[model samples]
Target chain A: MSRLAAKFEELAQSGRKALIPFITAGDPSPGFTVPMMHAMVKAGVDVIELGVPFSDPMADGPVIQRASERALAHKMSLRRTLEIAAEFRKTDQTTPVVLMGYLNPIEAMTYEGFANAAQRADIDGVLTVDLPPEEGQECSALLKARGIDPIFLLAPNSSVDRVKKMDAVGSGYLYYVSLKGVTGAGHLDVADVENKLQQIRANTQLPVAIGFGVKDAETANTIAHLGDGVVIGSALISKIETNLDNPEQAKNEIVELLTSIRQALDCGLGTEGVQE
Target chain B: MTEKYNMPDERGHFGPYGGIFVAETLIPPIQELNAAYQKYLKDPEFIAELDADLKYYVGRPSPLYHAERWSRELGGAQIYLKREDLNHTGSHKINNTVGQALLAKRMGKTRIIAETGAGQHGVATATVAARLGLECVVYMGAVDVARQSLNVYRMKLLGAKVVAVESGSKTLKDALNEALRDWVTNVDNTFYIIGTVAGPHPYPAMVRDFQAIIGREAKQQCLEATGRLPDALVACVGGGSNAIGLFYPFIEDESVKMYGVEAAGDGVATGRHSAPLCAGRPGVLHGNRTYLMADDDGEIIETHSISAGLDYPGVGPEHAWLKDTGRATYVNITDTEALEGFYALTHMEGIIPALESSHAMAYALKLAPTMGKDETLIINLSGRGDKDMQTMAKREGIEL
Candidate 1:
């Protein structure tokens, strides 16, 4: 089994939901990402989704876009992002780090080249925002061949056929975007998300990680009940955005925020891994 | 030449150059749009309505006026101007907007949105939306809003709410990202009228079909006037709508050559330009895979051009496929050369061309002199220079 499979199985065995926290690599500065990854792991994040900064972050809202701009200014790139992941893996080899971003950067670094670099870095998975299954055949196959799970996104409006297709092609958890808007723009309706998750559960067997509006402890805890995991992206980036002038303050805020959500998950989290 | 010149096989790949590469949230909506577009494309009723709108509303079949004076001065091939500049909205942009607006109404959409670089498409979208009594909103780069203020005011007068996008590079691509954001949020009642032959699947093919009216007319006019097809076709390519508009219908004409002029701001060598087809590699951006001006790190480089419309890092996917397949030759013109073409055409033929169109004019000037006098060339004059008077005046050190 792959690291993602083993990790999810371990989470299920412990009856604790996965808490995936996303942060753009090199956001605060070039020296900021490695320390932050260790900090988040210490704060009980199950999976660290490291955002590879691109000049055009179309799927992201203003907060994450700002994070990308800051990261890019430090010359952070796909190669640099992988180097950071490699740095994080030096001492801590158990935690799974998933690289998440747009696909052009990966295209620039050829698929075979990226897969080899990722394997060397011990990266676990990849979630390309704009790469749907229709265009993901080659890239997904390459990642899967190298034991890196290709994570696909399932939206609120995904059809049953698309869900099935994603289930067959995607190896790791499926990210369910709870709302119809860009990341960090709209308030997610729990009822709507719950209803959509039910349909998605009926169609796919891959673990579903709900994101796109997992804002606070309330929203995160609520989302934990609806899916196999909860993802927090812009909300965490917002903390970094607010504390750009002070890296220590930003790290403290991120740790504090993730800790609260971690506690929220532990309090009354649903242990039901896939509906009976 | 034995086979028909069909492209972008059903899945929208112009030989791996175009595909629907968007986030999952946009999948259902774009799929819905594709179904509607496919259904209405051959529908007699839809075609009739679109044709009527083009003829009566947009004043279509725009004249193919021979630029005899300019051709004589060039002392080479005969030059004819396919006068899309004389269209109702003063550009070829209106051709796509009118078709999409009518389609939006039929699809039961109540809100219309668009993104623009030079503001021509914004005004065109707003005009069609106002005619259809739908709410209109346009996204433009903050820099373009200041430079193309006349078209900005024109869009407002047509009842569009103009939003200046203050994001990455703050140009055409940024505006497109903002418009995509808006569409994802309001997919229920909103219809995004993509102004160029770019974006996701159906958009490139659909816009090409609508704007193909230009090539259809120009071909017929050239055949009627000269009793033979023109030897060459030239057009400026920003998102490549105008160029594709004039080239699609002639793709099977083995003897007819095509040239797409890209904006080389300072020079491609100086690394300050948007000549993607001329000096770029294939990459995915703005919902399609195409040639893009990206660094080795895959970050889009900031593109510079005297024409706002052409200052984009990526070109339409079809243009990429055309360049690769050798169906079209892609050339580039610098800001200085395009400006000279603008002035030359204005003085010689009494036709003031848009800075975007002047790129095509510049390339034609070079090629016309290289050809024999008996040969013929047609340049798609995609837009008028009325909106560019201020920029020209600024260049001349005169306060407009």
Candidate 2:
């Protein structure tokens, strides 16, 4: 099995939900990304979503957009991001790294090159933000050929029929955007998220992970029971944004944030896990 | 003729150029929109309603005038102008906006949102939303808001909330980014009325269909007036809607050659122009794969143009496919060349052209001089220069 599948199986055996943390590669700094990935893993993150910074991230709100701008200022590219993931694999081979971002960089690099490089970098999955299944066939096939899972996203507005279509091609997990808005926007109704997850679960056997508007431990815990995983992106990047001057402190702060969410996921404090 | 050449494939691709390259959160909404657009496009009632609005509200069949004096002065091919500048709200933008607004109403959407660089599309969208009693919001770049204050005031008067985007290069691309964010957030209630032939799957195809009226009308007018199709067609390409609007109908007519002029700020050599099809490579930006002004690292670079409407760093996907297939030729006109064309047309023909259209006029002026006097060339006069008066004054050492 792929590392992603194996990790999910391991987590399922432990009766615990996955805690996925996302951070833009080269944000805060390029040199800081590998260390941050290791720190996140040490803090009990099951999957690390390393964002490949694009110049215009239209789907993101201000916070994540700022992160991309900062990262781009350091001259970050998709190639460099894969290098960072490879660097992280030097010490930690068990942890799964999912490259997440818009598709332009990948399109520029060509899908075949990206899939081959990702496999070489030990990257386990890819969640291209802009590439839905309809447009993702070639990329998905390339990734699958390399034994890498091609993940997809499901949104609140996703109809049951849409979910079924996405589920048919999606692998690794289904990233369910918890809100109707861009990343970091507010107004996440927990009940609404639960209801959507129920609908999504009925159509797909793959684990469904909830992202967007997952700000802190409380919300993460609340969302924990509703899905197989919780993805925190803008919220963690906010820590780096607040601590830009001190890379060490930013890493510590992100680790602290992930630790809280991990504890919540493991203990089932906010709500009951599936096994519980 | 293949049925696919005129429109995008089922996946919204024009060759390898266009696709829905948006965030996963937006996929469902985009899919829903594609379905809705496809349904309404085939519905006779929907087409009838759109046609009625285009006729009565937008003032369709904008005159195709023979620029006899201007052609005589140029001393070349007979120059004809498709007077889209006379359309309501003073631009061809309303052609797409009215169609989209009607679609929004039919889709039961209660709100309309759009992005504008020069504020023409914003005003057009606001006008339609007000007519339909729908909530309207327009996102403009902060830089554009400062430059095009007149259109900003006009949109506000039309009862649309205007948001000034301050991110990225703070131009058309930034405003588009902000608008995409808004659409993704408010997918349930809002309809994004894209002003150009860019964006995700249905947008490039849908906007092209809405604006194709320009070509349809011009073809009929040309045959009636001159009794023959023009030897060449010319229009400025920003996000390329107007140019595509004029070029799509004539695509299969091998005798009718097409020219798409882009805004070359200083010149293409200076690396400051917004002529993506002329100088850029293929990449995804705003929702679709298209020709983009990006660097070696795939990061979009800032573009410069005197005309805000033509300042975008990307061209529409279909334009990319057209350029690749050799069906259409893309060229660039310098800001100085366009300014000259602007003055020449205004003084000689008594028609003040928008700076965006001036690029096409500049190219047509060059191409017309090369052809015989018996040959004919048509230019899609995309908009009027009324909105650009401030920019013009600023350039001439005067303040508005």
Candidate 2 chain B has its poorest 10 consecutive residues by lDDT at B1-10
* lDDT tens readout by residue for model 1, A155-225: 87888898998999998799998888888876789999989888989988788899987888888998987
Encode model 1's per-residue lDDT on B1-400: one tens digit a residue. Answer: 3347788889899988999999988999999999999999989999999999999999999999999999999999999999999999999999999999988999999999999999999999999999999999999999999999999999999999999999998999999999999998888899999999899998999999999999999999999999999999999998999999999999989799999999999999999999999999999999999999999989999999999999899999999988988989999999999998999899998999999999999998899999889999999999999999999999889996
Query: Which residues of candidate 1, in runs, are more than 4 Å off?
Result: A270-276
Specify the highest-DockQ model's number.
Answer: 1
Give all candidates' CA lDDT scores: 0.92, 0.90
Name the best candidate (by TM-score).
1
Candidate 2 displacement at residue B390 in angstroms: 0.9
TM-score of chain B of each: 0.99, 0.98
